[model samples]
Every structure is written in structure tokens, then in C-alpha cells.
Target: MQTTFTPAQLENPHTAHSEQIIRKCVHCGFCTATCPTYVTLGNELDSPRGRIYLIKEMLENDRPADAKTVTHIDRCLSCLACMTTCPSGVNYMHLVDHARAHIARTYRRPFMDRMIRQVLAMTLPYPARFRASLTMARLGRPLAPLFAAIKPLKPFAAMLRLAPSHVPAKAAINDPAVHAAEGPRQKRVALLTGCAQSVLDPKINEATVRLLNRLGVEVVVPKGEGCCGALVHHMGQEDEALGFARRNVDAWMRVADEDGLDAILITASGCGTTIKDYGHMLRLDPAYAEKAAKVSALARDVTEFLAELELPLPVNKTDLLVAYHSACSMQHGQKITRAPKVLLAQAGFTVRDVPEGHLCCGSAGTYNILQPEIAATLRDRKVRNIESTAPQAIATGNIGCMTQIGSATQIPILHTVELLDWAFGGEKPASLAGVEPRVEPALAAAE
Candidate 1:
């Protein structure tokens, strides 16, 4: 794993980090067993160790990434399951991130690839635009066959089929101005109304707010808080991601100063993991470095916060078989291993672990859309694993996992917060009640 960096490469920030990460690896291939792409493709190039070598070579030589390297790196889900399996503690997340940024800057993607990436980066983070796009997608679903003449249109059709037929009902947006609730405020937190979550399923945030309020925590959804930049960051759009990060940091800081803040709660695991790393991501930014660090320190996943609160358990115990789908970011990125399951079990639900739970369900942000073939394979595998458990319901933290797993399985896939909210005297999710008419296989399984 020794790196031979040229003089020019030594000056590159990314190469330096790659060199540091490379030295930590003892050439152990244990990570290969857990990597989803490697496990499915059975190609060394798709494995973490193989990708690390490619990244090391591309960076050390100070040359533009070639098509082969780009293909292998792009296939990665960034699930960080390798990190969990590696005994050496190699930081694959940072290494893969650096590789992605390098690829975006130096590699020239196909015209169609560029167009799709651009559309996702621009629309996914904006709620209004995303909502409009979903409506259009629904309308276009029927016309999918018309576009079948074009090869690229096939995946678009698949993506459209996966889109929820109807947007979940909107939840009450918490007003930051109103600080006090009827009960004594035990703690105050600014809940991140995520970009995709806001558009795809606003009810997730509603459930989050309801659960927090019930626990006597004053939940504040601050204005001007846009995307957490996770979408762009994963695409190697560092500038755009950092811009969103700075805006969020400033907005939350203002709220913290106005009304004493305890922590920033995020229901989405991907956003939570990235926000928690804002400290390191913005360490070099002169203007907002210190402020970004402060904000990052305050970020916490909803389950993490709830675990610490030790809230009272609900009186009624429902005998339901719950298969807990541990998100890659929650378990491997944040290292939040047991909080969600413990909370569910405490609430009187029988929580069972899905087989191959560490493997990514192929919903790595927009990965399912971009790499449809491999994503489908992984999704099918995950679906099979869940079926083996024969659980009445599937519970997951991140929305991407929920939707991806939902697309593959017939069982009702729900956010952990939604299940907790329902168990605590709230109504069941419509998807679970079989009230919503949809073609999603997961919805049918719920019935």
C-alpha cells in the first residue's frame, strides 16, 4: 500500500488524503466480502481494495481518470459497509468522495449522463421543482412506451414506475417563531426539513415533529434551510454542496442565538451523516469554518437523540413482526448500531434483523437511476433477504432505503420514525393501511 506520489501530486489535497488512507490498508481483502458491487459483480475492480488501488494510481500519477476507472468508481454505492468490515479502519467514505470529485472535474461523462446528473442536482434539492417533476413523471408514466424507441428512456420508465403514484399528504410545517408548546419544553431542536423528504414524503417530517413534541421537545423547522448538499456532494459537486452547508450553518446559528437550541435533528441518515461531517468538510473555508464546525457538532440523527432521551414506552404493545433494515449511513457512517432497534423493541414490537442487512439496497441517493443494472441486482437480493424473514413490516431510517426496498419487496417499507410515531398513539401510515391505491409491490405486500 505504499504510495509513490510525484512532486505535483504531493501538492494536491486529494492525493495527500489518499496517501494517508492507503497507508492504513494492510492489503487485506476482507472488505471485498461485504461490498455490494464486488459481491454481485464478482470483479476485483468493483471491490473497495481494487478501487483504492485505482484511486491511488490515478491520483499519484496526477493524470485525468480514464473511462475504466470512472466506471468502477461510479459503481460504488458509498455504503461504507467496507469500512465496517475492515479491521484496519480504512476511511473508504472520504477516499471515495475524493475520487468522485476528481472524476467530476477531470473525467468527461457521456452527454446523457451529464444531463441526468444536472437534472438531479438542480431539481432534487428544491421542493417545488421536485413536486412539479413528480407530477410530470406521473403524467409521463403512461407515455413511457412512446419513449421506448430511445434506449435511455427505458431506465427513465423504470424510475417513473418506482415513483409513488401520489405524494403523501403534507404535514404541518413547524414555525420557528412559535417556540413554546402546551407542555413544558424539555429540549429545543431544529429539525432539518430535508429536500427530497419534503417533496417525496412530507409525512416523515410530520411524524418526526409529532414524536419530538410528544417527548416535550420543541421542534423548529427554520426557514431558508435548503438541501443538506448530500445529493451534490455524492456527485462530487463540492462547491454546490459546501454552499448549501454554509447557508444551513448560518440559518441554524441564527435560530440557535434567537431561541436556545439543544441539537439539530435529522430524520434522514444520509443527511445526518454528512451534516455531522460539516466540521471537517468546511475546515478550510476561511469565512465559515468555525461556524460550520459548531453547527456540525450540534447535528444528530433523530434515533440518536431519542435514545439519549430514554422516553417512556407506550402502554399498548402490538404483536407485530418488524424487520429492521439498517441503513448503510446510520449503521456504518454514523456508527449508530442499536438505537433504532432498541427503541422499537422497547415500544413492544418484535424487531428482527433482515439477512445481509449490511449490504446496500442499491438506493445510494440517485444511484438506482444512474446504474440501473447493478442497482436492480442488489435490490433483488435485498428483497429476497427480507422475504426470508417473513416480517409483517419493514422498518428503515433513510427515505432512499425505504423507497428502494419498497420498490423491490411487497412488504410495507416505512421509516423508523413513522413506526415509532404510529406506535405512540398516532395513526398508521396510509401505505400500511392499504388505503392508497398504488402499484408498488411493497404496498401490496403490506396488504
Candidate 2:
């Protein structure tokens, strides 16, 4: 893992940082066993160690990204499972992120690839546009089979196939305002009403707000806050992603300066990971550097925040066994392993962990749409692991994982907060209507 960057190359901050990350690799290959691509594709180049070598060669030689390097790098899910598995503590997430940004600068993608990436960049971060596109995608969905036959149109086919048949109505919780605590406000927090999640399943944020309010936490959806920049950030759109970070920083910092926030809560674990990294992501910006660090310090996943609260007994506990599918971002990226499952168990459901829980569900942001074939492979693998648990339903903290797994399985997928909300006396999740919980022995005997 020795690096050979010249003095001039070392002068660039990003190069210097990436070189530091590259030097941490001990070439153990522990990552290969956990990498979804390497596990599925069996290509050395598709593994983190393989991709690290490719990244090192491209950066050290100061050459444009070759087809081989781009292919391997693009296939990466950025699940950060390698970071979790590495004995040497390699920061694969930052290294791969730097590699992606470099690819954006130097690699020229195919026309169709460029078009689809551009369309996703422009559309997904904006809720209104995303909703409209999904509506149009409904018409195009009928043509997915035709598109799948054409190689270049496969991403479109993936997009069409992934779009929900009915777009959810925009929830009122999305309005920029504050929901006061029921009694006294012990803590005030800003909720990240994310771009895709807001449009895809508004109930996540809704459930988060309701549950937090009942627990005496004031939830505010700041007016200027938008996407967490994760969607485009993973695509190597560095400038666009940074733009999103800056806007959110300004919006949330305003609340921090005025009312003082205890936490910036995020229901989507993918966004939570990126939002929590705002410190490192904006460290070079002199003006935003300190503020971004403060913002990142305040960021918390809803489950992480909830695990701290003193809970009353569940008002509507069920005997349902929940197969908790930990999102890659939640478990690997943020290292939040136990909060959601513990919260579910405390809320009176039997929580079971999925086998191979360290692997990604292949829903790393827009990965499913961009790399449909490989995505499908990993997703089916994930669905199989989830189903073996034989739970009444599946629970996860990410909207992306929910969508990806729900597409492949018959089990109802719901956000963890939704189940917690229902248990805490809010309305039951509509997805659970037909799922019958097992009767306890005593109750069955009494009946």
C-alpha cells in the first residue's frame, strides 16, 4: 500500500488525503469476503482491494481513468462494509469517494450513461421534478421489457421497474414548520425531510415527527433544507453535492443560531451518513468549515436519537416477529449497529437479524438504477437472506433499502419509526393490514 505521489501531487489537498487513506491498506483482502460485488461477480477488480489498486494506479500516474478502472470503480456499491471489515482500518468510503470525484473530472462516459446520470442528478434532488418523472415513468414502465432488451436503455428499464405504481401524496409534515411537544420541550431538533424519501414514502418523516413529539421533542422542518447531497455525491458530481451541503448547512445553522438544536434528526440512514460527514466533506471551505463541523456534530439518525429517550410502555404492542434488515449505510457507514433493533425490541416486537447482515442490499443511493444487472443480483441475494428469518414483516431505517428489498420480496417493508409510532399509540402502518401476528400461548389458551 505504499504510495508514489510526487511533490507536486502532494501539494493538492485531496491527493494528499487520498494518499493517506491508500497508505492505511495492509492488503489483507478481508474486504473481498464482505463485498457484494466481489461475492457476486467473483472478479478481483470488483473488490475493494482490487479497486484500491486501480485507484492508486490512476492517481499515481496522473492519467485519465481507463475503461478498466472506470468499470471496476463504477461497479462499487460504496457500502463501506470494507471499512467495517478491515483490520487496518482503511477509510474505503472517503478513498472511493475521492476516486469517483476524480473519475468525474477525467473520465468521459458513454452518451447514454451521461444522459441518465445527468437526468438523475437534475431530477432526484428535487421533489416536484422527481414526482413528475415517476408519473411519466408509469407510462414508460409498460416499455421496460423493450428497454431491457436494448443494452444502453437498461438503466431506463431499471428506473421504470423501480418506480412505484402510485406516487405517495406529499405529507403535511413536509411543510416547513414546527410541531410542538405535547407537554414540555426537553429538546429541539431539525428533521431532514430528504428529497427522494419525502416523495417516495412521506410517512417516514411523518412517523418520526409524531413519535418524537409524543416523547416531548420539538421537531422542526426548516424552510430552506433540501436533499442531503448523497444521491449526486455518490455519482461523482462533487460541485452539485457540495452545493446541497452548503444549502443545508445554511438552513440548519439558522435554526441552531436562533433556537439552538439538540440534534439534526434524519430518518433516512443514507442521508444520516452523509449528513454526519458534513464535517469532513466541507472541511476545506474556510467559511463553512467550522459551521459544517458543528452541523455534523448535531446530526443523528432517528433511532440513535430515540435510544436515548426514556420510554413509556408500548400502548399497542404486537407479537409480530420483525426481521430487521440493517441498511448498509446504517450499519457500515455510520456504524449504528444496535439502535434500531434494540428500539424495535424495546417497543415489544421480536427482532431478528438477517443473515449476512454486513452485506449491502445493492441500494447505495441510485446504484440500482445505474447498475441494474449487478444490483438485481445483490438484491435477490439480500431478499433470500431476509426471507430465511420468516418474520411477519421487514423493518429497516432506510427508504432506499425498503424500496430495493420490497421490490424483490412479498414481506411488507416499513421504516423502523413507523412501527415505533404504531406501538407508541399513533396509527398503525397501512402496510401491516394483512400481516397477522402469532398469538401468545396464554392468549390462545384463554381463547
Candidate 3:
């Protein structure tokens, strides 16, 4: 692959960065076999190599995004599986992100597409507003059929269809400032109570606190921490995303400066990937650049941190069989492939891998809502492979994957931490409340 950016265009920071990424590609079509859209739509334009060419053309010409380029780029899930598969080590994530930001600047979308994108940008990154909007979703759900029939408003129909009919009570919002370690403190770390995960499944936070406290790790919920900006960042809302990034850096830096943090533990793998990249995202900001790099250094996924702690093996735990669905962000984006499954096995559960583990489950942030038809195709394909493992429950590290996979399967879904938490000393998950807890005989004898 070749880029023809003029010397003047190459002087621009974004163009310079994209040029570096583009030059790494060797025109290998290995990426096509792993790309979800290419596999489903069978369009060369839908694959990474095709999109790279489109991006290279758009950047080199320094012109507005055309309909063909926008269509192919918008369909991309940004799963980063191609990054994992590429032997050349091309940085597709940053390249795609830069292309999206360019699209946001130059593409003039239709009225409905603009409105839908606006609604998502304004609401999803803010939890209280999102909850309020969800409250009104019932009124819109009835109109889903009508919206779906419209040419440009089908994503709006998908949004209404995915909205939960009943919002849970607010008691479990998990707003406590700090949870003290149950015993002598071994480490003190801040926990990211992110936007959507807190609203969608607050219990994941609770379980995290319990497991950390039991392990003698004090947990601090930084007051000003909010969304990780991943939801908006991937949408090409560059300034808004950077704004959220800086605010969170300020919030978390204050805590680290005052008390000291060994690690910043995150449960949501999608947020973890973005949080870990705060360094690269803010590299050009002179003021935030150093602080963002420091924050990224301290960030760690819960499973990553737990693996460091070398958690004690589970005692008297049932021999539960679990199909571990690795989130695309976890396995591919962050390259955290084995820690979660290893933790599951160490916690006394039989962990099995899904067949197409490298593929995205169609829950790349807002990808599902924005591209419902293609998203559904990938989701069904992912579910079939997961179900073939014959497991009693599914375990994952991402709330988005849990929501997407849960919609398609009746199998009990647990956050990897939730299962690990309960297996040690916490209460059994409500879904498994009736089942008696017992240790595997082989595990018991070994212990």
C-alpha cells in the first residue's frame, strides 16, 4: 500500500500519523478472512484492506468523504481482530479512528442520520440522561415498526427495540466513595465506575468491591470520574471525546496525587482498552500529555490485576461449566487473551472457549444500534458458536457483549469478576441461587 500525501498535508499531525500507519500495510488479504463485514457482505470494500485503500485515497486527495468510502468505513466494527491477525503489525485501530474523525469533519449526513447520531452522542455518555431517555423509550418502542419501515430511520427503530422496558431501582447505583479493604490493606486502587456499565449493571461494581476488599485491596471510587469517552470517540466526535478524556484524567490524577494508587482497576474491557490508550489519544496535548501517559501506565483490567495478586484457589465451589466469551476489546484490542479464562479456571469453574473466539460479537459500542441488520447477523453467528460448548452459563468481561449475547441466549451470563467474587466468599449469583454449592472432588483432594 502507498500514500501520496503532499509534503504540506504530511505536516498536519493527523495526516502524518495516518501516513505512518498506512505505510505499514503490505496489501495482504489475510485481514479479509477475519473481517466480520467482509465475511457477511462479501464486498471487498467492506474489508480492512479495502477500507485502508479508501482511507489512503481520501487522505491523499484531501477531499470530503464520498458515499462509497463512508458506507464501507461506517460498516466496520473496529473489533481490531485484523490487527491481531496482521503479521505486518499494522496499527488498524488508530488508522480507523483517524478516518472516522475525518468523516465527522467532512461528511454531511442526512437529517435523520444526523438526529440519531446527535441523540446517541448527547445521551449515551451521560448515565442519568440515558436513564431518563430510556424511561421514555416505551413510548417510542410502539413506533419501532413504523421507524423500521423508513429508509434512514431504521437505526432509531433498533434503538427503541433494544431499550429495556423496565428500568431497575436506583438503590444499587454503587455511589459509595470508598470501600475499605476487609483486612490489612495490601494495595489501594481507584475503580472506574463508568457511564453505561454503572447504569446497565451496577452489580458488577458491587461484586468488584467485594472481591477486592476480600483480597485486602482497598477500592476508591473517584468522585469526578465519568464515562471513558469510548462511546463518543468511536463515533468520530473528536473534541467531545477528548473533553471527556481530560476531565477523567483530572479526576483520577487528583486521587493518585493525594492517596497513591497501585493500579486503576476496570471491569469493562471496552472501557479498559480506551482507558489504557489515554496516552496515545492525548499525546498532542502539551498539558495533558504527560499526565495521560502516567494514568495509562497505572490502568489495568480487573482480571489483569487479579492475575498479579495470584488469588487463592476457590474452596467448596460447585463444578460449574462456563463458556468464556472473550470480548473483542479484551482479546483483540487490548491483547488480553488468556487472563480471564485462566482466572475462571483457577476459581474452580471449567472454562471452555467459543469456536470463533477472534470474531466480534457485534457489540462494538454503538455498532449494534447503528447497523442493526449486519449486527444481528454477527450476533447470531457468535451465539451459535458459544452455545455449541454445552456450558451451563456464559462468562464475559464486557457489559456490551453480555447484553448482546444475552438477547440471543437463555444461558446465564456472569461477569468474569462476579463469578470469581462469588466463588471465593461472596453470595451466589441470584440466577444460580437454587443450585447447591459444592467443591469438585478432584479439586477438593488437590487442595
Highest-lDDT candidate: 2
lDDT of candidate 2 over 149-265, digit per residue (tens): 999999999999999999998788898999999998899999999999999999898888999999999998999999999999999999999999999999999999888999999
Give lDDT for model 3.
0.89
Flag the better candidate by lDDT, 1 or 2: 2
Q: Candidate 2: where are CA atoms >4 Å away?
A: 440-447
* Candidate 3 TM-score versus the reference: 0.96
Superposition TM-score, candidate 1 onto the true structure: 0.93
* Worst lDDT 10-window in candidate 3: 167-176
How many clashes show up per model?
1, 0, 0
Weakest 10 consecutive residues, lDDT, candidate 2? 432-441
Sorting all predicted structures by TM-score, with the top scorer first, yields 2, 3, 1
Per-residue lDDT over 146-260 for candidate 1, one digit per residue giving the tens place of the 0 to 100 score: 6545766655765676678887554456334343443888999998988888877788888888888888888888877878999999999999999999999988998899977
